[model samples]
Target: MTTTASNSLQNIVIYTNNKISLDFYKPFEDGLNPILFTVKTLEQIPRKTENKIHIVILESCDELSNLQINCNKIHLIMPAFLKNKLENDLHALIFKYEQSMNSQQALENLYHSFIKFYCSAEYYLDPQDFFNSDSYKDGYRCINIHEILQDNVSYEQQLHTYLNTISNTETVSFNFSIGYEFSSESGYLQLIENTVDHLTYAKDRDVFFSVVLSKHPLSDNRLAIVHLSQ
Candidate 1:
């Protein structure tokens, strides 16, 4: 699948290690509404839109450049000290997992690091607050959740937690609103349980797999999708 602008201008925010890039569909036009801000500037950008905004944080500018070839609507930004802390945490987790000699344990460590990084840095809304906000009116808004993992079980557990929590009633259509970055086929199936549902995987070399859940099994009123990548 290719990244295309649906309609109207969507606001996107990105945080990275002082460098990044974006890639999107061709026929790129002007007037994109995304804002690029450093982590330090997050407080300056008050009144963030709920449904119309997207955010991404890369490890470095080179990663950003690689992303530019695949996504067009991304708003690349630099992270504050948080990025460094997250990186340090990730490094420690990875190193520990590698020494354990268990691939599954390693993957779990990576997944946990990913979740912690996003929850602690990018997403300002608490889980409860996110569900209550007007931005969640149509359901959960689409968000790209990324993580680098070393094993499958850890990834699966993370998916289970995310889907189960977001789909809960208090979430008010939260499951239908977000996308994910995953590393395996089992993880994908775990998120989309039905064989009847159609899955659209992206052709971009950088994106490993993607699926948009048009409807959630728990409720017909809510819609959601998940995107995964290695």
Candidate 2:
């Protein structure tokens, strides 16, 4: 299954992995369901069978400059080395733009910049904490030590602190989606429902969290959250 968000001109592909089951949440819309896709028979789909699905979130689309697409079965074409170079260049461009803007505009520009540059793609980071550390002077990339530590912080305290720090700049909100493995056993839906409940009831409002579970060795079951303010 593939999930994509697009406006009239640009499309953003959010995810593209060949996992049997996936779940995600987007902001609520008056006439649309927040649960984007709930495919139960994904395992039956043949490998390399490309399928396209699009969702229209009016508000999100309005703010978006490009469409985001997430696929469960498609392969991204770019080579790793080239992709990294492109990502780094994009980061530099964004940083330069941020430096040119005032604080308030910088924040807004940062969001749009990320959406344009890094959405639906993974960027490489050094495992030695060289880039992740808060002391790092370079802030050109997103996967730094500051973000790793920030993700592990207590949701409540972190959210409150982040909001307070950025309060003068931009208003922020949190959204979460819990993705679980596919199950043939009964009560699978109930399990997912409970997980969603836990995420919704979570006290964090400063960092948006996304919970993903996969059997792939490269991936792990954990909450992937990012702070988005202004």
Question: Could you give candidate 1's per-residue lDDT for residues 76-177 as a string of tens digits?
Answer: 223221222221111011112223233333223322222222222222222222222332322223333334222334644554455443322221211211
TM-score of each prediction: 0.25, 0.23
What range of 10 consecutive residues in model 1 has the weakest lDDT sum? 87-96
**Tens digit of per-residue lDDT, candidate 2, span 23-140:** 2222221111122343322223233323322111111222222423222222122211222222221111112222333323432333222222222211211112112222222323
Model 2 TM-score on a 0 to 1 scale? 0.23
The per-prediction CA RMSD against the true structure, in angstroms, equals 15.8, 17.5
Model 1 Cα shift for residue 139 (angstroms): 17
On TM-score, the candidate that comes out on top is 1
What C-alpha lDDT values do all the predictions have?
0.28, 0.26
